[model samples]
Target chain A: MQKVFGRPKGLTEIPFHYCPGCTHGIIHRLIGEVLEELNIIEDTIGVAPVGCAGFSLDFFSCDFVGAAHGRAQAVATGIKRALPDRIVFTYQGDGDIAAIGTSHAIHVAARGEKITSIMVNNAIYGMTGGQMAPTTLTGQVTTTSPYGRDNGVAGFPLDLPKAIATFDGAVYVASVSVDSPKNILQAKKAIKKAFRVQQAGLGFALVSILSTCPTNWGMSPVDSLKWLQEKMIPVYQMGEIKVAEEVKGL
Target chain B: MSKVLLKGNEAIAEAAMRAGCKLFFGYPITPSTEIIEYLAKHLPEAGGTVLQAECEVAAINMCFGAAAAGARVMTASSSPGISLKQEGISYLAANELPVVIVNINRTGPGLGGLGPTQSDYFQSTRGGGHGDYRLIVLAPSKAQELYDLTMEAFDLADKYRNPVLILADGFLGQMMEPVLLKEKKEGNLPPKDWQTDGCKGRAKRKIASYFLVNELAEEACQRWQAKYDQIKEAEQRWESFYADDAEYLLVGYGTCGRIAKSVVLNARKQGMKLGLIRPITLWPFPVKAFTSHFDGIKGIVTVELNAGQMIEDVKLAVNCRVPVHLYKRQGGMLPHEREILKFVGQVFNLPVRGEA
Candidate 1:
């Protein structure tokens, strides 16, 4: 019981390289834990994205492959095709997934390529030093958006989870956050559901883990959590976007 | 075991499925569209997928998508369509995906005519797309070659986890010939040991192809190069006809290879010592076999449906002193054996092979 919330054996023992108070590590732990609980450590292959989360491959104990910027979905598609019996997924950050990888993700869903995508929405490019991201919220100030994400010039922030839900090909989708304990539990359940859909042969699945970027957001660990609760939650929301309940024996 | 008359294009699509292919994504193009049409009617029956994509670009990307899901996949197109697929082809190679593609070539730089052509010699054998990637390319001359080469392509692709291409010209795709099909095996390829099928009982898995660290991509590239050299050593394919102690030789592949064969046989009766060289593996080029004959021969004339494309290789193989001449036609099939026999007479200094 003590080890229930503990990390999965599939995750390596190495500490994360994430900046202080960043929820990327937390999201990683949750995903790893789910993999262990399911007992699929040996069969899992991870497609790492181009952001700081790109190295999520090294943190995971299982085999890994890295994808070009915004191309994790495409890479994941290939991997899944070649070995349809394995449980494949990708770990992508906001700038990597929603921006450059947007079209790929869209097409992946449209094709329903029987894989899972774990997208971490941190609102800024952490590795490149807080540049604007496609998911960067309005009024959010970053190194690139010094004027606080000017809607006039930078355009509107993308609603990723909702945007993806409209696709007919994706069988399961959700936008979960790391702000509260209740929300964290919900996020885990969402991640679990995404995997379950694939297990049930329900075609494409994706789970967007709404997270925080303390270093890039220019806030302390505590303040970052507070900001995530205050600003990001209402917008990103929490819940399963779609599910094939009938196929899953609901 | 079954043998049936099949066009090269149809043989390819059928052989792909018989080898455990589950998905085919392609757009229609001349010479190769028959492959798509066949897959559309057959794949669904095999519990596989077949989609006519919006464009060659979209078609190849769709192959990328199916590939990610851990499925055996392929796509077919001609020269122009292949040009559009180069980007996705690069991405597929970058990921080290096992994809099978069939390109029935037509003439080109711009919407080249639908007639047969081997102008894509460099593009198919040499790395056509960006990056340090080489697709294992097989050039098939007959419908039987198509059946056998496609099976080999899938096996090689899976063995190395890379893409394999079958380069046949319009002649192979549109022409009909007898093909003996192998026994259908249930589940021949290894299951996607790395695919994401959901982890209800065990753990999460991910499959992708990307290497960012310069040293890492380089290391992977080196690994791939080593694999290619090994394949080159083992699988370079060709056939020889009447070359044993011959005075002159004709060099070609696919349609040109067949055309050269007829002339070689006719040149035999005339007592002129002329042999033929047909390369089945375009990438490996069969350089040593084709060129070494020059040590004893007087001249080598390379014939093809393209203006002197393969002649370049012959010269490179035999060296400048060997007098590597070119016999070429453009956007059309090369004329029959008589046209070639006329040249054989001139090159070998023989009197018109007992009338044209």
Candidate 2:
């Protein structure tokens, strides 16, 4: 008997601590596999943001620095600057990257820091319950926006990858999804390409993956996938949003 | 061993370089801006890196990143800027990463003037950020002490795996004085066993402050607290002047300490039996130094550039064994030597004239 699939070498044996039906595990697996496929697991330094993504330090078998909320890009910049030869990446959640760390996102891109960032966007803050996040869909219901996200009051959902793609320093800006097997494979490809971009010392690279928080969204695992496809895919422009001609072949 | 005249800020920058600090990240703030400016021009020539961060918040966090990557890093700012850096400093302290932070103390409560003040004694001594942590605060009185203490600060930070702050005032930072700079001390650091450089063929490492599990978090907190306790015992430094047979003790630090020394000199010449105790390490508070002089002192007068913040620590050290007094000049104003001397004479009921 042959086992066609096994745990990626980038992931540790420890089980993830995410809530049931959460897609964080899927995104983590994709990233872990990407790290292994890129042959960067040994030379990588990961920065984990505060929130559910913060536990990435324990799940990845690489050097990790747990950063303060929204400071993942800043920390990643520091680590990458200090050790230019080492590959550095930051794993962050929507709340960690978009809500509180928006300035870091804009500035890190503007400066074109040579590091990789993976933002798991679930449209809600999962670690602190179903709170409204920067990517919370318009008219969507969450704990913070109980009456549904009113664009008039809460403002419209931020299409971050599209916004980031405008920055010249962001050589590779990808908005991916892990809602299906095909999308999962595409997510892995984007994640791998992001790391490869870092390996080549290209400017900043970011892969924002549309993930699902089933426990927070009051949906089953199957329905969460359906909701992400039906709702999120329409809002956030999917596929590679930005690719510098310098790394177009990569 | 030739002495060179340098501003206090530049002296700290040079001394840091001499101590093998190769990374400096900072934002410009008054009085402390020269440190970053000097590093920007010189660190590149010394095969180091200097980054002008967007803000103090980013600068301190960058220090955390550089320090975690096994670089001797530093950041400098003034009072308002230091306030902006508190969050990152808390993270550094909690993670037990070593870095140097220089606070050229300026007047504050709100964006105050760019004059010297000791108002941040509480902010530096008592943890400025949110957490159960302590920064090893070194208060330097002059350019020479600033250079010496900046060099010592790097070693102390690495030794304890904690942040060390050089707490200076605006006057000390802006003033220029002759200092005998030491030769570059290379190869003094031990290998950083816990740096997050890479995990290839080695056990994985984490630079983090979070412990989600209840018992593990409690245990980690206890371990960090134990480190603070050990630091307090091993690093309480102070200097005493003319205290062998003195009756009055003038307690001060930074610029105030230098001022108190002059008061001691003039009062002793007038047969006033006064002495000075200058706390070099502000965090450990040098309680033992205060206790040692409690036996013969009639009073402890704390002279500060703020509204009597360190006076509380002095009173705590005295424990009512002797009368404790405070002479303060608030909001960037400095206390004159004669004013401190007059306050000392009144505390001891001595003659107000120079004949005391």
Per-residue CA lDDT of candidate 1, range A110-188, in tens? 8787889988887888999999998888989988899899999999888777777778888888888877898899989
Question: Candidate 2, residues B1-356: lDDT per residue as tens digits?
Answer: 77999999999999999888999988998979999999999999999999887777778888989899988899999999999999999999998899999999889899998888988999999999997789999999999999999998999898898999999988999999999998755445666899999898898898888886889989988998899899889899999999768888999999988988888989887878889899999998899887787778888888888888998888887887788989999888888888888887787788757533
Question: CA lDDT, every prediction?
Answer: 0.79, 0.90
Lowest summed lDDT across 10 adjacent residues in model 1 chain B is found at B195-204
Worst 10 residues of 1 chain A by lDDT: A241-250
Q: Which candidate is the best by TM-score?
A: 2
Candidate 1 residue A152 C-alpha distance from true site, Å: 6.3
Q: Write the per-residue lDDT of candidate 2 for residues A1-250, one digit (tens) a residue.
A: 9999999988999999888888889988888888888888889999999998778799998899999898888888788888999999999998988988888898789889999999999999998988999999999999999999999999999888888889989999999998889988999989999999989998999999999999999999899989999999999999999999987988
DockQ of predictions, in order shown: 0.24, 0.81
Candidate 2: CAPRI quality band: high
The alpha-carbon lDDT assigned to residue A78 of candidate 1 equals 56
Of the candidates shown, which would achieve the greatest DockQ relative to the real structure? 2
TM-score of chain A of 1: 0.95
Fnat: each model in turn = 0.33, 0.75
